[model samples]
Each structure stands twice: as structure tokens, then as C-alpha cells.
Target: MPELPEVETTRRGIAPHVDAARVTELIVREHRLRWPIPPELAEHVTDQPLLALERRAKYLLFRFPAGTLIVHLGMSGTLRALTEAFPPEKHDHVDIVFDNGRRLRFRDPRRFGAVLWQNGNPLTHPLLAALGPEPLSDDFSADHLAAQLARRQSAVKQVIMDNHIVVGVGNIYASESLFRARVDPRRAAASLSRIEIENLTKSVKETLADAIAQGGSTLRDFVDSDGREGYFLLQCYAYGREGEPCRVCGTTIQQIRQGQRATYFCPSCQH
Candidate 1:
């Protein structure tokens, strides 16, 4: 699935072509996604100018005068900007044709992505209403993380990955952040000290920022709106380097399964 950085990258890539452009047409080739695309989505958004484009967690918000169009790139979804003459491929499921002749196309091989209409404030939508603060925001500070973790008995990585604690700290980023902070993934969340929490918070922010700058980590089926794969995977420290020498201490990186997801860490480095 595309994480925060990937989604944000997509938002930035397509914003210039889509924002402020009038939607001349809304085409839904396949409405059977993770959630069925609203049959009336075209009726609601057609001819409306996209006021702005924003991202909340992994969802993309296309703002308009009447409401917002919320899209989630579930596991293998890719949104791209193409010309009106561009041919739709097998997986191309939807397109929003703009007055400028550019079309925003959504392709998902797995059909796990979602397209929904929000008639009111998008933040109040049930899917987004209870989401925690954005990980890259000022509101997600060390103190905030500490308070949330103190109430959870789950593993440190699991707690951090919880969307209710801090949005968009997915499995790969969680392992990378904990490794950077030198905190063991298996540690109980409530057992972290203040200093550890601070380090973890900083690591999370830095890791995410770096990934965004590199265009996000592309393990599989992720590409920006321009159809470019992310390069962040080349800079990973511990996420997938199992049995390899640690970059910092030359210790053999180890992998374990927590919450059914693989976690990588340096035994000699992370406590």
C-alpha cells in the first residue's frame, strides 16, 4: 500500500494539472473498488472546479465548492496525469478529464483502491473523523507520542503504527524509525522513557521527511503521478536488510514478525 509520503508525492505531482481546473468529465470504468465508487460521483463533481488538492493520511482530497472527492490508493493503486488522447490500459479504472485537456487517471491492478464522495466537510467523514494527527505536523510532538504510548501495552512498533496514535506510520516506516531511534521494536510502548520517546518522535519525522524527499519507498506497485518509482528504498537502514551487516555497527541485521509484519533491526544497535 502507498504510505503518507507516496500519497503526498502523488498529490504534489497532480496538483498543478488538476487544481483550479474544471472537471469536464468524470469517468468510472470500474466502480467495484475497496468501496464501490459512488454511481452519482459524476453527477456531483462534474463541471465543478477543483478548488484545491490535499492529503490526509493515505487519502487524497479533491476539494470543490459543493463537496470533496476522497480517494484511497489501497494496495496497488496509481494516480497519473495523462493527456486526453492517452489510451486507457487494462487497470485504468477512472479518469477525471479537465478543461485544460489533462486527465487524472486512477489505475489499480488489485482493485483495492477507493473512490468516494463527501458532501460535507471531509474531516468529519467517518473514514477520516477519528484519525490522529499527521505525523509530519507540529501537533505530533514527543510529548504527544509519549501521552499516547503511555496508555498502550502493545509493542512499541505496533503502538507507533497505530493510526489512532499518529497517522501514516506504516509497517516499513515504523521499523525504520525505531531502528533509527535505537529502540527495540518488541519493547512495550508504555515502557519507553521520555528521552526514548523524544528520539523516536524525531526519527519518525526525519524518516518520513526523507522518504518524501526521495519520492517515497517503492517496494512494489507504487509510482508517482508522473509514473516514476520512488528511490527511498535504496536508503533504508534496517527494514529489509535481514542477515546483512548493519550500516552503523556492522552487526548482522535481524528480522522478526510482529503483528504479522516483518520487522528489521540491529541486535547490537537497537535496545
Candidate 2:
């Protein structure tokens, strides 16, 4: 799944081509996605200009006067910007044609990505309404995390990964952030001290920002709009280096299952 950084990277990559560009047409070859692409999608935005491009959580927002087009690049989806009208591939499900002759192609082999419409404020839409503050926003502070963690007995990693607690800290990032904070992934959320919480908050921010700068980790199908693979995986310290030597310590990185997801850490470096 494309996490915050990967999603943000995609937003940045395609915004230049799509922003302020009038949509000539929106063609949905496959209506069944993470959610069915709105039937009236083309009716509303066919000739309207995209006013702005934004991201809330992992969803991309294409703002226009009529409404906002929200997109979620689920498990194995990519929205690529095309310089020319290239023929669609086997998995290419949606295409947004621009008046300028450029294109935005959405391809998802697993068919889990979404293209939905929301009137008024897209943030107020049900899918995004309950989402917590962005991990990079001022609303997400140590105090906020502490307040959320005060009563939770779940593992710290699991708690931070909760979308209601803080958005964007997915499984990969939770592991990286916990490793950077020097906290064990198995530590109870309530067991973290004030200092640990502060460090964890900072670590989360740093880890995410670094990943975004590196174009996000390409662990699976993630790629920028240009079809470029991310290089952050090479900089990973723990996420997928199980049984390998830890970067900070000589201890071998270990992996365990938490909530059915892999959690990697260095036993010696993290408590």
C-alpha cells in the first residue's frame, strides 16, 4: 500500500501536469475500484479546470468549482501523467484527458484504488471526515499523541499506526519511527514516558519527511508519476532487513508479526 510519503510524492509528481488544466474528458474503463468511480464523474468535471491538487491522508484531491474528485491509490495502483495519448494497458482503469493533450492514467491490477466525488468540502466527506490530523501537521504533537496514548494498552507501534490517532503512520513508518525513537515495537502505548513520546513524535515526522524526500520506499508497486522507483528502501534501517545486521548496532534485525503485519527492529538498539 502507498503510505503518506508515497501518496504525497505522487501528488507532487502529477500536480504540475494536471493542476489548473481543464479536463477534456474522464474515461472510466473499469467502474469497480476500492469504490465504484462515480457514474456522473465525467458529467461534472469534463470541461472544468482543476483548481487545486491536494492530499488528505492517502487520498488525492482534485478540487474544482463543481466538486472535488478524491482518489485513493490502494494496494497496487499508480496514477501516472502522460505526455502523449499513450494506449491504455491491461490494468489501466481510468484516464483523465486534459485540454493541453496531456493525460492522467490510473492503473490498478488489484482493483483496490478509488475515484469518488464529494461536493462542498471533500474533507467533510465520510471517507475523510473521521481521519485524524496529518502526521506532518501542527495538530499532531507529542501532547496530542500522549493524550491518545494515555488509555491505550496496545503496543506503541500499533497505536501510532491507528488512523484515528494520527494519519500517515502506516505499518512501515510505525516500525521506522519506533526504531528511531529507540522504543521496542512491543512496548505498551501507555508505557511510553513523556520523553519517549516526544522522541516518537519527532521520529515519526523525520522518518516520514525523509521518506517523502527520497520519493518514498518502493517496497512493492509504488512509483512516482514518471514511473520512477523510490530509493528510500535502500536507506531503511529496520523495516525489511530482518536477519540482517542493524545499522546502528551490530545486533541482527529481528522480525515479528503484529496485527498480522511484519514488525522489524533491532533488539539491541531498541528497548
Candidate 3:
């Protein structure tokens, strides 16, 4: 699945071509996604100039006068800008064609992505209304994380990965952040001290900022809107480095399963 950094990367990569451009078309080759594509999405957005392009969590918000179009690049999904109308391939699902002959195409092999229309305040939409603060925002400070993690018996790794605690800290980022903070993934969330929380908060921000800067980790065919593969995985300290020497301490990086997702950490470096 595309994480926050990958989604943000897509938003930044495509905004230059689509922002303020009038929608000439909204083509949906397949309506069966994580949610059904609203049948009237084209009628609702056609002719409206996109006011802005923003990202909330992993969803891309296409702002327009009438409303907003919410797009989620699910597992194996990608949105790319095309200068011309390339013939749709097997997984090519939707297209947002612009008046300038440019096109924004969506392809999802797993059909778990979404394109939904929302009127009024898009933030109030069910899919978004309850989301936690962005990890990069000031609202997600150490105090905030400490309050949320208080008395929670779950592992610190799983707690940080919770969407309600802080948005967009997915599996890869959670592991990397914990590794950076030198916190053991299996440690109880409530066992963390203030200093540990401070370090963890900083690590989350730094890891995510670094991932966004590096274009995000390309796991299983992920690419930016411009079709560029992210190489952040190559720089990872723990994720997918199982049995490899730790970059920081030369101890073999270990991988364990948490909540059915892979968790990687350094035994000597992380307590």
C-alpha cells in the first residue's frame, strides 16, 4: 500500500500539471474499487477548475469549486500524469483529462484504491473526518504521542502505527522510526519514558521527512506520479534487511512478525 510519503510524493509530482486546470473529463473504466466510484463523479467535476491539490494522510485531495475529489492509491495503485491519451492497459482504471490535453491516469492492479466525490467540507467526509494529525504537523508532538500511548498495553511499534494515534506511520516507517529512536519494537507502549517519547517523536518526523525527501520506499512496484521508483528502501536501517548486518552496529538485523506485518530491528542498537 502507498504510505504517507508515497502519497505526498504523488501529490507534489502531479500538482504542477493539474492545479488550477479545468477538468475536461473524468473517465472511469472500472467503478469497483475499495469503494464504488460515485456514478456522478464526472458530472460533478467536469468543467470545474481544480483550485488546489493537497494530501491528507494517504489520500490525495483534488480541490475544485464544486467539491473535492478524494483519491487513495491502494496496494499496487499509482496515479501518473500523461501528456497524451495513452491507450488504457489492463489495470488502467481511471483518467482525469485536463483542458490542456494533459491526463492524470490511475492504475490499480488490486482494485483496492478509490476515487470518491465529496461536497461541502471534504474533511468531514467519513473517510477523512476521524483521521489523526499528520505526523509532520506541529499537532503531532511528543506530548501528543505520550498522551495517546499512555497505559496502552500494545507494543510500541503497533501503537505508533495506529491511525487514530498519529496518521501515516505505516509498517515500514514505524519500524524505521523505532530503530532510529533505539526503542525495541516489542516493548510495551506504556513502558516508554518521557525522554523515550521525545526521541520517538523526533524519529517519526525525521524518518518520514527523509522518506518524503527520498521519494518514498518502493516496495512491490510503487512509483511516483512521474513513474520514478523510490530508492529509500535502499537506505533503510531495518525494514527488509532481515539477517543483514545492522548499518549502525554490525549486529545482524532481525525480523519478527507483529500484527501479521513484518517488524525489523537491531538487537544491540534498539533496547
lDDT of each: 0.93, 0.93, 0.95
Better of 1 and 3 by lDDT: 3
Sorting all predicted structures by lDDT, with the top scorer first, yields 3, 1, 2
What RMSD does each model have against the real structure?
A: 0.8, 0.8, 0.7
Superposed by TM-score, candidate 3 places the C-alpha of residue 88 at a distance from the truth, in angstroms, of 0.9
Pairs that collide, model 1: none
Q: How accurate is candidate 3 locally (lDDT)?
A: 0.95
Error of 1 at 188 (Å): 0.5
Stretches of candidate 1 above 4 Å error? none
Candidate 1, residues 1-271: lDDT per residue as tens digits? 8999999999999999876899999999999999999898999999999999999999999999989999999999999999765888999999999999999999999999999999889999999999999999999999899999886788999998889889999998999999999999999999999999999999999999999999998878799999999998899999889999999999999999998899999988999
lDDT of 3 by residue, 1-271 (tens): 8999999999999999987899998899999999999999999999999999999999999999999999999999999999999899999999999998889999999999999999988999998999999999999999999999899999999999988889999999999999999999999999999999999999999999999999999899899999999878989999999999999999999999999999999999999
Which ten contiguous residues of candidate 1 have the minimum total lDDT?
A: 81-90
| Native RMSD of candidate 1 (Å) | 0.8
In angstroms, give how far residue 260 of model 2 lies from its true place. 0.1
